[model samples]
Target: MSDEQIDLLFHAAVELQQRGMWEQALTQQREAEGLLRGQPSGARRDERLAALLYGTGGSLNALGRHAESAGVLEESLARYTELGAAPTLIADVRMRRAVALAATGRGASAVIEADAAVRTHLDVGRPSDLARVLQLNADVLADHGDPDLAVASADRCLRILLQPGRPGAADARYLFLAARRASDLHAAAGRPDPALAAAEIAWTSGREQGFAMPSDGLRMVVRLRESGDLRTADRFLKELRGLVPDADPASYPTPEPSVTLAQAMAATGATGVPALDPRDAEAPFVPSQRSAAPFLATAHATALSAVCLSALPEDVPHGVRLGLEAHYLFAYASEAQDSDLRYRFVTHGALWARVLLALTLALRPGDPALADDLTGWARAVVARLPPTTAEAVEIIAAWIPFLDAQDA
Candidate 1:
């Protein structure tokens, strides 16, 4: 086969990966790998083959096939070294491989690989590449090595990315993610002040860049509350409420169930909704009436019921995990206007309310203050529902007891 065939497949795989179609992306990547494997041995073939392996490894990692990903990435690393690939390219592979290794329970080796990758990038001195590697290294160290060491690495990465007027400074999204990670690490290490500072950075940058969500504001609120700064937390909580939509059903004409779900997702900036079985990784990327919505909401009236149930005690813990993960996807994909207060007040409000409900499930249980914060925001979601929507009414009825239990 021609090299163009391989290139097309690789590009398609990357596009699918970016669209969050990990299973499809892995399939495309493996198809390309097969084509490359069949090619004759030569420098050009070897280079393409190595890159193909790298892409395949990435798709594997995204699909949670960590051991397979590590093996594929290791071969890619060897091939790239033999081809004398650029330091930046090799370092990128090493960082990804390190993550795969860590996921497969080789935390010590993961730290070593990530640390080596960071050093390689430092030697090359590309501001963006070095900063990226350093951030990954910090995460690896935090998970496997010392928290203090991880904080130092995270701080160094922040310094490079936050440098004013530095050529090739990281993008807004990267800066936001790194700051959030730093905040979590600091909070975990019992450094509340630094945690608040880093959380502030994430919140500020996320807003300025139009990617901020209630979750970002909630992070700051949580940190402030934890630090015994109830006054500040209350103020932030007010601002956070402004980001949520008041899901009043009378605000918009009801559409078909699937269309309502789709529109709600669009308003929240969520790309896809999972099927009822979160374990079914092969489900369609988007929800459809014929396929996903019914399976998820059969017990309740509205499609939004799945989101609420997933967070409640009736659902399995794993379902709650999946729901929260989807919630974050919505959070990060959100633009300032997409999730703005009262945007299409009906569906948008319902979606945001359910998202907050899911969050209440994820928060450290037994914190009455935090639980109150979440429940209050979510209750406002269903407070305006029309009596005709029996399904939503049923879910809200159950939700009251859950909220009462929180206070109890």
Candidate 2:
């Protein structure tokens, strides 16, 4: 293919991928591949082929076709290895392959690949590439339920990223992920104070950089709820909702499962308060429109609204419940990381929301399996929070009694 044609295909593939038309992006990439195959082999030809394969793999991954992504990325890795490509280039492909493996549920294999990539980047003296590998390594570790190691890897990356003259945005991103993993580890270990501190750092850094990611703030709210400081937690929740207006409810990303459990606690009045109207919940706490009013005075009004609304009775309109759940999920999912917390929170929240909707609006108690599924989800959320959110834990604790009584 002509250089001009390859360039056009590459650009087209990138645009399609960005637009979330992954299938179309893959199609464009395949066309580029076919064009390249017709050309004579040379150094430049190999480089173009590598680029096409890498781009194709990325698009396939974006489309959730992980196996296909792994195949394409493997091809790219082989070509890069053959060319004796620069350290960063090889490290990048290794990172991509590791991610594809993790996505395909090969966590142990992913960790091995990611570790090698991290070592390669470190050896090559590329701090940025090292940071990326560390982040990906943390992800794989977390997925494998090794929170301590995940936190350690993330913390190491954060240390490097916070050094003098580091790139601001990327540094902020690393700090955010590191804080998130640390908070999760703290929570799992029943250390609330450290979790709270880590969450605060994550939120502050993200906000300072105008990161607009919600997962960090969502984690903070969960930790605060666990600490029995509902008032303070409300403030963070308000900020979370305000930061992500375009976030989709069903697939919103959260930093951890504790955040979703907190939302669920609010929904059931287990937090020892009445739930507020989801719409009005965020409305009262909007930080951008400050006044002398207590709710209006804070920087994150939207989250406060969520806390208030979640405390309300389940008898509220189905649409209102769904909206509240959506907001909660959206806030939780807003973080940029692909950690276990993000996955669990989004998946659990989606399942819980559906169950609530079905019970309150569509199905009867006699509906086979619905109640069981809902109960199972509630238990999962409760199991995830750390001891720091004592209020949240107590709320869930009380729920067990309540549910027991109802069952009796």
lDDT against the true structure, each candidate: 0.62, 0.58
| Steric overlap count per candidate | 0, 27
Top candidate on lDDT is 1
lDDT of 1 at 182: 76
10 residues in a row with least lDDT, candidate 2: 281-290
TM per candidate: 0.57, 0.54
What would the per-residue lDDT of candidate 1 be over residues 1-408, giving only the tens digit for each residue?
467888898999989988889999888888888888888988888888888888888889888999999999999999999999988788888899988977775654575567557757766757777777767776676655444446666666667777887424236666777777778776765667877888898898888887676666777877786688999888767766666654221332211111222333334443334323211223111111112222222212233335445435554343333343343223222211233323343554455555556556665374344445446545655675443444555556657876677558
TM for candidate 1 is 0.57
Measured on C-alpha atoms, candidate 1 has an lDDT of: 0.62
Q: Give the per-residue lDDT of model 2 (tens digit) for 14-99.
A: 99886778888888899889989898988889888998899888887788888888888998888888998887787788778878
The candidate maximizing TM-score is 1
What alpha-carbon RMSD in Å does predicted model 1 have with respect to the real structure? 21.5
